[model samples]
Target: MAGNSDPLSPRAKLAVTAGKAVAAASRAAGRGSGSVIGGRVALKLDPDLLARLAQNLDCVLVSATNGKTTTTRLIAEALRAAGPVVSNALGANMPAGITSALAGGSESKFGVIEVDEKYLAGVARDTDPKCIALLNLSRDQLDRAAETRMLAENWREGLAGSKAVIVANADDPLVVWAASSSPNVIWVAAGQMWKDDAWSCPSCGGVMQRPGDDWFCGECGFRRPTPSWALSGDHVLDPHGSAWPIHLQLPGRANKANAASSAAVAAVFGVPPQVALERMYQVQAVAGRYDVVQFEGRDLRLLLAKNPAGWLETFSLIDPPPTPVILSVNARGADGTDTSWLWDVDYTRLTGHPICVVGDRKLDLAVRLEVANQQFQVCENLDQAVQLCPPGRIEVIANYTAFQDLRRRVGN
Candidate 1:
């Protein structure tokens, strides 16, 4: 069990060294995205760098339209009970990000990776992970991700021939269908709050019957698989019908489901359920998802809402009677160029609440909120928007690029 006893081939070793040098230079130059650049250089030199580095490691791959980053962090923390764990905690989820994380943590025996939904299959195929956690799949970055169903199909095809044990959300038809073919699977009723993307059966193309929390297809009789783990309130029920209380510093029921999924993945590796849940409670924030930072003389709770589903879950986390909330949007490459998804969100939920829209696409959000008959103001800058809020702690929900910018500004 000595550290990375197998040395890389000379060529691959040189690639890693050069990539590290570039990463150092990029960091010194104040480029925060050095991981991507360094990984790109290493992969360009050695196409199979990720596979080589991942060899002989117990790896867990996590993917979903949302919650993948937080879930990955939770699983990584839980796995620390076993030994050292390497993960992409910086939100670099693509192949380059995975490569960067693996290269940096070469000595670690365990890896927990947050694979982008689009790159799940490719990364899984390369890493040959021992376990794969498939969280709920919903529409995200319509312009970039295309469609939810198509991505699920891609995942089904990509995971072919793999012997990995699959941990999947049973409530989501798309997740169920995508993972059905896997030989070994652990199902968890992690709860799916957004159902627009899963209204129809992915298999029979028939209308699904969602009576209470369970769903079934009327046409093909495809129904929700019996779950080995179920979330009841704040407790996760094990197969033996015992409940384990989950305490997390992160807010929302969505995070509870995330913790349940992480605990299931930990079980696959023989980590006790209580141990997994205990380790997860230690995680205060994943990147900057739920960190309260001082900004513009007000405490701002940073929440990331990239799609309609994300918005729905994030809105539920807002305190009732609605405190002042700042909504920021951006149509940058990472945020997806299509701002039309704004119309898909049920902004009506915020009916009597005070909202201030900011970011480059603030006008678009203004129109959406206005059409919903919600009261909101438009601000050109995030600081001005924060200033408009009534004193005390304010909730700030933002899309990808805007969220990153605010996190950088808050120095979180």
Candidate 2:
């Protein structure tokens, strides 16, 4: 591994193999149960070193069960409108990844980053951000997160003494309960909607009673506070029609929370709400999250659904195509080795839909599709699937690992 003092020349720095070697050596320092999470180093050496290099730069950290990436990107953009900024906008939420992003910057007033829940505490400790944005906690990555309560505890302990102002989503009851004890917390929420879900209380384990999309714990009666900040008004104008437009570059209910969280962070930084809203519309896609691209004559949308919550969100986005749609699933490490999460998704949304299935897990995805009564054509591989489709015009949904693998294979 290259020592901090052994600065390599620009030509040598461009070598990918050498860089990976250095990263591996850096990983070696904190051995046994101290592996890097969200790309931030475990020993705290790298971030501290990098922070000193940048002269204790002001920073913002965004953490959530979902929408961290999109929210982080939007916050970074809004901050950028004020000045230059650094962030893990590419989805590297661990310590080492945070180091990599900070290392890439020259100088900035703020380092805006999206942190994974598991690594949030450590990164928060090391980075010591000036602002922390907590989006709602939903059940995600049962294999990794274990349960939402575990994560809530992690945040509770991790952020115990943080001087940084806390921004939380009021719509998520779990977040509301957690922030109730926070010293300097601000709430952001989404209004009631027709397609809304998650009305359960995280406290006292009871079904929540909603008074117009506003939830109160049945057993504990812990009511959510109105938001200090929100993403949209009563309604917004979509191309189709006006509905509460999230004003984010991405689509869906989850993304709205992401947008609102970003706005909350921007507001904390003293960026005018109007300026934040205006800049949000200018932000671009964060790659595989919900990136749409054009092929031959078809519109291809690619989403990286890594776990049950993400999978359900992606499945819900699949509109009944006027034409046949193609769905692919892969078990590549990026998508995840365990494909059991497939059973948890509400594949019923695909019922009566025309579609095709492909990838190593094609048969498995097909079985799930069959349960929905969706007709599917089998393809030997992704290449075969894309060839079968009209090049540029098809919808492609894959888990995280599969999304990256397909992107490399298809040259997207």
Candidate 3:
């Protein structure tokens, strides 16, 4: 009984270490811990963390290849409007990280977490969430995740239960097929949310046909419907090209999906659709994700692009390219370690403007830019890249490592 302590003690321990471990895990990621192989050692060292989550009344877990952080933040904010809500806002989606956030927080009506796909099943088993949101599956960190199909298989097996409601991205064939058999499930679609590419039938492996601007699986005919609460318009409407006339707060099309997905889950919980949208737009962008920082005399937009799909979406949102772009790329072992994914990104959009590429893979980025037919200025350092660019409002597209570097230099 000495170590058994209280039933909730494990949860409390997880909460206490959630913030600290994220900080440490982030720092020590590539150093060891075997993060490169999708095998996480952090959760193993902390056994009671999962048990602690099982004690919560209502818990919501968000998992996907993209938009997890932004969408999760939006969900937390929506819940906060009604009352206090606790979350792991620092982009730590792993089991221990989620447990830490929950255990650390005081009592509340609901628990919202943005979980990582690699750890989703484990998190779900331990947390016993009232609901779980599977955003979308995509090819990401091939070195660690292996492939999207493999991860999907793991998700299907792990999510077999009736304790939670499954909210999924209808636009994604993989997610649609994965959740089709789930009894307690609700599906939401972006419905022309942006230029999406993940449309196909997971069941038949045929090209998922697009009914309208949106997509569906033709072979299986398992087309997910758009959530009744999705935002639709003649156009996304960007009055201000450079500075954002309407001020989305969260830049790009991907953020739109994040916001919409967040809204969908909140709505399912009885939060009004209008209320969810209002809270989503009103919420400030999560720090370092797609935050716009005002530096000395210049304004800098910080957009994080950790994978091919993410980078493509970020590129789409740039509108008229920056007079000069500051691009930062890094493939630290902690962040998938392998930079080969860059090869999959269609960097050709940069051909219209000159880019100042920075980060650990500066040279490779430059090579990519050139191959994409983009004109760029290669800088050995991120700070220097930011420096060489014109002052007033610089657009910075950075990955995980580059984001860290930009934060250090910009005092973020």
TM-score (all chains, Cα) for each model: 0.97, 0.80, 0.83
- In model 3, state the lDDT of residue 202: 61
Poorly placed runs, candidate 3 (over 4 Å): 1-46, 191-200, 214-220, 225-227, 234-248
- TM-score of candidate 2 to 2 decimals: 0.80
Which whole-number lDDT from 0 to 100 does residue 344 have in model 2?
70
Highest-lDDT candidate: 1
User: Where is the poorest 10-residue window by lDDT in model 1?
Assistant: 1-10
Error of 1 at 85 (Å): 0.3
Ordered from best to worst TM-score, the candidate numbers read 1, 3, 2
- Best of the candidates, TM-score: 1
After TM-score superposition, the amount by which residue 92's alpha carbon in candidate 3 deviates from its true location, in angstroms, is 1.4
The 10-residue segment with the lowest total lDDT in model 2: 234-243
Arranged by lDDT, best first: 1, 3, 2
lDDT of 3 by residue, 27-112 (tens): 57654222211213334545665555446546788888878888788888778767668787877667655655565555566778
Query: How does candidate 3 fare on TM-score?
Result: 0.83
Evaluate all candidate structures by whole-model CA lDDT and list the values in order: 0.90, 0.65, 0.67
